[model samples]
Target: MQTEYDVIIVGGGLAGLTLAGLLGHQGLECVVIEAGEKIDRVDSVPDDPRALAITHASRNILASFHAWQCLPQDRLACFRGMQVWDENGSGAIAFDSTELGRPTLGYIVEQAVLQTSLEQAVRSLSGISVLHNSRPCDIQWQDDHVSVILDKGENISAHLLVAADGVQSACRAMAGINYRVHDYRQRAVVCVTRTALPHGEIARQRFLTDGPLAFLPMYPDHQCGIVWSTRPAHAEALLKMTEREFNQALQAAFEHTLGEVKESERRSCFPLRRAEAEYYCRERFALIGDAAHSVHPLAGQGANLGLLDAASLAQLILEAGVKGRDIGGRRVLRSYERWRKGENRIVMMTMEGFKYVFENQSSPVPMLRNRALNFANSFIPLKHTIMRYAMGLSGDLPVAAK
Candidate 1:
């Protein structure tokens, strides 16, 4: 293996792999260092309860990296419409693909399935190498290049270092970058359920007193991935309940939107928090994905945002290379930072605002928010604009995302 490359990516997760594949396709030598073992393709369909909402822009970005082609067609669940309502009031908003003259709103894909397909796509690129079960123990940023010292005593050097490690990113810490975090004091309970009635290819979200509850349609007509964000105590209680008891609680929470919750798979829970790096890039080192920023799952947009970050950063790097400019120079790296930071901040703040409004169950706040929802729904042009933004069609997207 080459000890020197054009770029060295820290973290072989979805974002890192996507970046590597894109750069490799552009003929840049890239290496990805992952802490986990290489994951094989999942033979079972829709086995993972954790699902991701792939926006229209995200699909375009994946197709650019050729990862979308690697995904199993049977495992993808495309939702044509969405419905969001408030449980405390009769205010709601609905969106359909036809409103924008599109084929579908977005896709709901299992997390494991997407990652495995991306891995396969990255590995297929001749200029890219994935070093699984290897982690960077030390990093030295020089004037012209960055050196990564791995735990296995291997030394790797690159013109640029990209950190796509998750929220608890070691690279971010090693780079001595500060990040601001806001804890929601809640937990998101996730699982898959088989409802008595079909989902009708529509994603549903109900804003309860605590947080948001989303039922994302999956591959099967009667199965859906449920994300219930609530208080920590409530999430714990839901997890401890038996299958039948949990089903009843879920059904009650959703008000039998899809009839009864007949049965559900195993349950899982994770704390909710949003974090953003103080700086996205400096010198030869740059941050992407959760390492740069992370948001609440209210919109299931964390993954989509990360993918956009990769595409944006990759586009800038490629552009600089074509111009014979130093791809890792501060000028080049800062361009990527400037383009993504504002876009990501807008999304993070939007999710935070939504969470705050939905959680404030007080009398006037709820009434005001409900009215706002209804008013927005009644405004046709505004509703279509919001839908387009949510679908990622009306943004200053990178070429890959476009």
Candidate 2:
């Protein structure tokens, strides 16, 4: 017998789970099918090597769903300032949250902690159901609904099907949406390191000819999260180096900003790629998070973008349902696509432009880039606009927020 639901969400990651919670809160019946066997407790003390720089808009959305407060206070670290410098020059630009009258520019949150919080929120909603250890083997879209075949040979049907899977999205592929992909020929090496001095709630980034090296301030002061984007060969070498050698290399690259780096946790690497689907939705299917688009992590906007996608998509669905419209209709889903696609494309283009400008080795380019940075730093109005955009407050938003 096939189980039926109003919505069936594939991939129980952050985006899927958060959407499930939001829809359930609105009294919608939804079921989440997760391929993973289980969700476990996230290490509370920032032991995870990866963290996300969550924006204010994302926080607001999560708070509305009553999910943000579930995170442990100790696990969250607020950054009031950010400094960006040219790797070849002494020129730099800095942004302070006080300049914009905001208490924090953003928060650096552990990936596991964020995921666990969303999972807990999902579990508490009575209208949402979770199925683990299952993957969608097939999807069949009908005139009024869609059917999903699980790996266990069980069929499930729903009025709407949501795909929150990552960049290599099986759901998007199954939906037959046109997508464009670009391989950056770069890899991001992420790890945790104990600094000699406290970070003092400041996040830093250095733009080098190879790529960008970002230091995200984490809780407990002396520990920081490192996302070093470099060429694949260089990243591989760095990953295999001994602890002392790795620390030395890291310290040199960062110009000893945090003093001597002593130790590093597990190091991992992921290829940098950009993917944007032609549309975010079809008749009875929708795509959210990485499944829809993925930008470079230079600005640390990947996860935040995914969260925004979730919030906006949820709002659109709920409002349509409230109006007694066909929630899965192409017309309803088109609104989501039209709203989110353009915004995502702009960010992707901006990141690509930044990557190209900073990664060029021409001596003349550095001076020009540094001048631009200094100008941006000295200009109050321009800086404020940039800050607002970075805070996720200035982007094109869904009608729910309005």
Candidate 3:
């Protein structure tokens, strides 16, 4: 029996494509099965309505793949500072990159930009191929390898299989992985807002009794990516508002931090939920990105966490190959699982803790949180440590990120 590939990654997304690029760079044969043809050319995807906070480690990984260079130089905005506060109390804390001896904290970017870059890099690299307009209908796991059956009757077999199919992953479902989903009873309303004032290269978030509202800077303009998480009923009402009316509400939400939300794209909303798979991997299989876990978007660490998942899994697989061991072996996959799962869990829980603190702004907690924020702000070392973690520079990261 001949193994067709070293890996067959389902869902040609940020995690899968990045993993393919890394493994391909190492001379491993890999195939990425994508659901749509247009996904292969993500540059054509409109740059509208959404953005991500790319961490420093994620940038390094992209740079190693030569994908970072593909992003438009002018379309990148680097934020040097972050300010987070409570709407009901004086619990305010600010972080500056200068304190951490770094020029910037993170880059704000559009997902389309990253998708195009990763797909392009994967295509250029040797030993990796993407099957566009292809979707896997079934997965057959054997003692030695796994075979993916495509809807088009195509068969792809590999020593290892990875699921990067997203939060509601079909692959995860096939694997019988139990997902714990907690509904926040909230919806995240997002849009591109043309602010009256310049963003000044800062990321700002204000936590209200309902939820958190974020203003992330965008490139080459005074535009901000606004992500407002609130109750579903409130989100419905907000979504029903006229553009002018919505911008007015947006201005009120931020309390005129950027003056007025003068112009904005058609706003959209998605239900908020926290989900985690029972395990990150099983024999001959692994999960990455949203397939493995999803954190609250309030922290803006979702994709950053996914990139690290890709890097760490690839690192472990490559190491297993070097030792002449089965890369898809349970032990090899466990090592990757243990590392990524733990980190993702810790981050998710921390976000939950923060969310709870913000959502329950009763009386005593508000005063306590205010004091905690002031204390954290006044204490330079503690603030630097927190900022460092947010920058993705504080842990045992893969070589690609380093």
Please give, for residues 1-402, the per-residue lDDT of candidate 1 as tens digits: 689999999998878988998899889999999998887765743345788889999999889868899999888999999999999989999999998899899999989889889888999999999999999999999998999999999999999999999899999999999988988899999998999999999999999988899999998899999999999999999999999999999999999999999999999898999999999988899999989998999888898889999999999999899999999999888888899999998898888888888888777998999899999999999999988878888778999888
The top-ranked prediction according to TM-score is: 1
Q: What ranges in model 3 sit over 4 Å off?
A: 1-3, 39-43, 46-48
Counting clashing residue pairs in each candidate, in order, gives 0, 0, 0
- What digit string (tens of lDDT, one per residue) describes model 3 on residues 60-141? 9888878888777766789999999989878899988888788999999887777877788889987988888888899999
| Model 1 regions lying over 4 Å from their true place | 44-48
lDDT of 2 by residue, 1-402 (tens): 339988999988878887898888888889998887666565543344688899887888777778888888988898999999998876789999999998999999888788888787787888888888988999998999999999999999988999998788899999898778899999999998999999999999998779999999998999899999999999999999998999999999998999999998889898999889888988899999998888999998888778778878888888889889888888778888887887887788888888888898787888899889999999999999989888888888754332
CA lDDT, candidate 2, residue 273:
92
Where does the lowest 10-residue lDDT sum fall in candidate 1? Answer: 40-49
Query: On a 0 to 1 TM-score scale, where does candidate 2 land against the true structure?
Result: 0.97
**Structure candidate 3, residue pairs in collision:** none
Which one is best on lDDT?
1
Q: What are the models' TM-scores? A: 0.98, 0.97, 0.97
